[model samples]
Structure formats: C-alpha cells, structure tokens
Target: MTGKSLSERIGDLGRRLAVEAHTAWLAARDPRVAWFARLLAVAVAAYALSPIDLIPDFIPVLGWIDDLVILPLGLLAVRRLIAAPLWSELHALAETASERPSSRAGMILILLIWAALLAIVYWAVRTSPLH
Candidate 1:
C-alpha cells in the first residue's frame, strides 16, 4: 500500500482531475487538437467544471462512483485521444495556469437546463391524477 492516507490520496486525485479538466478546456479551444478530440474535450471540460452531475451525490455509492470513475475515465479518454506532444504541452500550461477559469456561459446553460427539467416535472405533477 502507498504511504499516503486515504484522504490524502483522494485530495491528490481531485487536484490531478482538476488539472486534466483544465487541459481539456484548453484543448477544446485550440485549433491544433484533432476535431474529434476537441469535441470530446469540450464535453469533458464542461462536465468536470459544472456543479451538476449526471448522478446526484445524495444517492449512496453510485453518485460518488460517477464522479470518481466516469470523470477519470473521460479524462483518460481525452488524454489518449490527444497526441503525446500536444497533451504534454497542454498539461504543462494547465499546471502553470494560476487563475482557474470560470465560464458564465456554462453556468447559464446549466441553469437553463435545470429550469427546463423543473418545468417538465411541474407539468407532470399538475396533470397527474394521483396529485
């Protein structure tokens, strides 16, 4: 077993994931990256940075699995899809990037998505005979 405690290991993983996500964000915007890689990069970056998750965290086990498993897999896929040299350059830039980037557009999009889902739920509840 590694010397680090579980919490410490988890923290390190989180940091590494953040950096990888940032790299994907950078790759998505760069013309040097392949078109398919760029497409997946945009998705990975958006999902990683977004406050919402595909699986809500309140659920036991499965919720954390999505964060711990799916995200890392996505990051790994993006890394593999990118050429080695390009990945290394982006990773370096991501590590050195002092200010963590925020996206107003992403936030807005999430909000809009939530709003639409809420509306659908509300309509369903109102129209239901069991209500």
Candidate 2:
C-alpha cells in the first residue's frame, strides 16, 4: 500500500495533535464559531491539561478507557461540529506556532477558579440548610 508507515503515522499524530490544540485555542475566541463549539473547544483544552481524569490511570482497564476511548471520541465530535474553513485556518496558525506558548497567568487563573469553587462548597456545607 502507498499509505504511511508506522513511524510516519506516529509523527503525523504528533503534528495533528498540535494542530488540533491550536484549533481549539482559536475556536475558544473566534466569534464565527457557535457558542457551544467555543465551549467544547475550551473544555477539550481543559481536559487535556487536567491531571485528574474521568477514570484515573491507576485503575486497570477502565482507567485507560477514558483516555483512549472517551477523549478521542469527544475530540472527534468537536471536529465534526467545527467548520472546515475555520479548522484549516486554525491548523495553519498552529503549524506556525512550532514553539508552544507559555501561560503562567492562565495557570494562576485556573487555580483561583478552583479555589473559589472550593470555598463556596465549603461555606455551603458548613451552613447547610438541611442540617
């Protein structure tokens, strides 16, 4: 077959992931995309970055399922919903960004958001109306 070799396919996957990541970042901001699409893009990016998984990797089979099955399916769903022209444009932009961007501020912001959520939950539990 004239298809790519195993090594080539592996390289292609690496490149494709970079492009998808770039597209997701772009989609999060582009007004041309629908709100739901934007949200999906953001969620995908967050899921990739998050250390905590839907199923933790320590578990035998089920843990890998989230990483192997769920994440890819979710990304595929997002890709199908995204406009082709926009995806292409974002992919081109992603290709140019060979060196990934840094965002300490973004990390801090995310941490703050989690902290705030925890605080609210804590307060609610401490003053439970049911109690």
Clashes of each: 0, 0
Report clash pairs, candidate 1.
Answer: none
Best by TM-score: 1
Worst 10 residues of 1 by lDDT: 94-103
Give me the runs in candidate 1 sitting further than 4 Å from their true place: 98-131
Query: How well does model 1 score by local distance difference test?
Result: 0.93
Over 52-100, each residue of candidate 1 has an lDDT whose tens digit, in order, gives: 9999989899889999988989989999999999999999999988356
lDDT of each: 0.93, 0.79
Instruction: State the TM-score for model 2.
Output: 0.59
Candidate 1, residue 57: the lDDT equals 89
Residues 1-131, candidate 2: write the lDDT tens digits: 99999999978876676567666877778888899988998888677657999999899989877866666676776778788888788767867786578799999999999999999999999899886
**Residue 82 error for model 1, in Å?**
1.0
